[model samples]
Target: MRIGLYPGTFDPVTHGHLDIIRRSCALVDRLVIGVAINRSKGPMFSLEERVAMLEPICAQMSQDTGCQVIVHPFENLLIQCAADVGASIIVRGLRAVADFEYEYQMVGMNRALDDSIETVFLMAEARHQAIASKLVKEIARLGGDVSKFVTPEIEAKLKDKLASS
Candidate 1:
């Protein structure tokens, strides 16, 4: 089966992420959403919280698309995480030219490490192109509406998280 890995911090999975996840189902039989445990970034949500949030959404996507979708949390190198998940393709969502510059370097480094695994870039839909998790969190923290960037469920979670924090 063709398995693909899409790695991200997913502090709070945004609509942009869902867009990529939905589209990625067409390219692979199994899509593994790799939730990275990068402490350096100091994510708003815990690793477990992030995984919890993605599970239900992924399950729904799998059911809808007939493609197996699973969330895997990883603290190791992204390339190593891909191998662990048996992914031959690493799917990445591109929002703009700025994202490409960073992703380009990552693709090159990943290729140098494992030439067998290929990286595929999917452009975010125009509407979602501007929706980023960081921006979503920022807007939420400042008491702004984030309904446009996240699902209603996620929006509630964000509000709850912010209220508690």
Candidate 2:
């Protein structure tokens, strides 16, 4: 089976991420959403919380797309995480030229480490191109509406999280 790994912090999965996830199903039989445990970033959500949020959504996507979707949390190198999941392709979502500049360097480094695994970039839909988890969190924290960037379920979770924090 062709398995692909899409790695990200996913502090709060945004619509932009769902767009990429939905599109990625077409390229691989199994799509592994790698939730990175990057402590350096100080994510708004805990690793477990992030995984919890993605599990249900991924399950629904799998049912809708007929592609197996699973969530895997990783604290190691992204390339290594891909290998662990038996992924030959690493899927990435590109929003703009700025994202490409960083991703380009990452691709080069990943290739240097493991030339066998290839990286695939999917451009976010125009409407979702501007939606980012960071921005979503910022807007939510400031008491702004984030319904446009996240699902209603996620919006509720964000509100609850912010209210408690």
Residue 141 in candidate 2, Cα distance off native in Å: 0.5
Clashing pairs in 2: none
Q: What is candidate 1's TM-score against the reference?
A: 0.99
lDDT of each residue in 69-165, candidate 1, tens digit only? 9999999999999999999999999999999999999999999999999999999999999998999999999999999999999999999999898
Residue-level error in angstroms, candidate 1, position 62: 0.3
TM-scores across all candidates?
A: 0.99, 0.99
Question: Residues 1-165, candidate 2, lDDT per residue (tens digit)?
Answer: 999999999989999999999999999999999999999999999999999999999999999999999999999999999999999999999999999999999999999999999999999999999998999999999999999999999999999998898
Residue 32, model 2: Cα distance from true site in angstroms: 0.3
Instruction: Assess each prediction's global lDDT (C-alpha) against the native.
Output: 0.97, 0.97
Full-model lDDT, candidate 2:
0.97
Please give the clash total of every predicted structure, in order.
0, 0
